[model samples]
Target: MPEAIQFVPYVLVVLLTGIPTWKLLVRVGLSPAWAILCLIPAGFIIVLWLIAYRRWPLLEE
Candidate 1:
């Protein structure tokens, strides 16, 4: 096995989680800029998501 292959799973996980996170954020008042904070490399995304969801009302179903 190659070293790069080992990271493939982690990379896939980021994309998988990122997509839905972005969609959920976009559903609320946050702009795409804020929603895409999930792409950042730290707890910033999780904290932002939590705050945003807590602050904004649900936009739709």
Candidate 2:
């Protein structure tokens, strides 16, 4: 049971980072679920590159 406590902070961190990331992706016309990528090792970089190079839907208008 004690070991489970160690993961609480990590879960909080993921939620803190993920919620805003999800919102940002949505605003940029990407799926909010893409924010789940940020939870993986080095996945934030992958998402960053994808967002940087991909054309935003808002800009198309």
Candidate 3:
């Protein structure tokens, strides 16, 4: 496989994960900048844990 082709899947995966992370953080009243953590090592795990267990301060009535 071409070296350049190998990067395509990686880029796609980032996009796939980033968009949802951004939206989820926003929905829960967190800063969208938190989504960038998804691109860092072990950050995705932290984000998932936060999303699963943290209480959202902006819950709609």
Model 2: lDDT to the true structure: 0.84
lDDT to native, each model: 0.64, 0.84, 0.84
TM-score of 1: 0.57
Q: How are the candidates ranked when ordered by lDDT, highest leading?
A: 3, 2, 1
Per-model RMSD to reference: 3.8, 1.5, 2.2
Order of quality (TM-score): 3, 2, 1
> Per-residue error at 52 for model 2, in Å?
1.7
lDDT of 2 by residue, 1-61 (tens): 9999999988987888788888888878888888988797587778778778888888999
Error of 3 at 7 (Å): 1.0
Cα lDDT over the full model 1: 0.64
Give the C-alpha miss distance for residue 18 in model 1, angstroms.
Answer: 0.1
Clashing pairs in 1: none
- Residues 12-55, model 1: lDDT tens digits: 87687677666766766565555455555674467465755575
**What ranges in model 1 sit over 4 Å off?**
35-53, 58-61
Better of 1 and 3 by TM-score: 3
Report the poorest 10 consecutive residues by lDDT, candidate 3. Answer: 52-61
TM-score of each model, paired residue for residue: 0.57, 0.78, 0.78
Backbone N/Cα/C clashes per model: 0, 0, 0
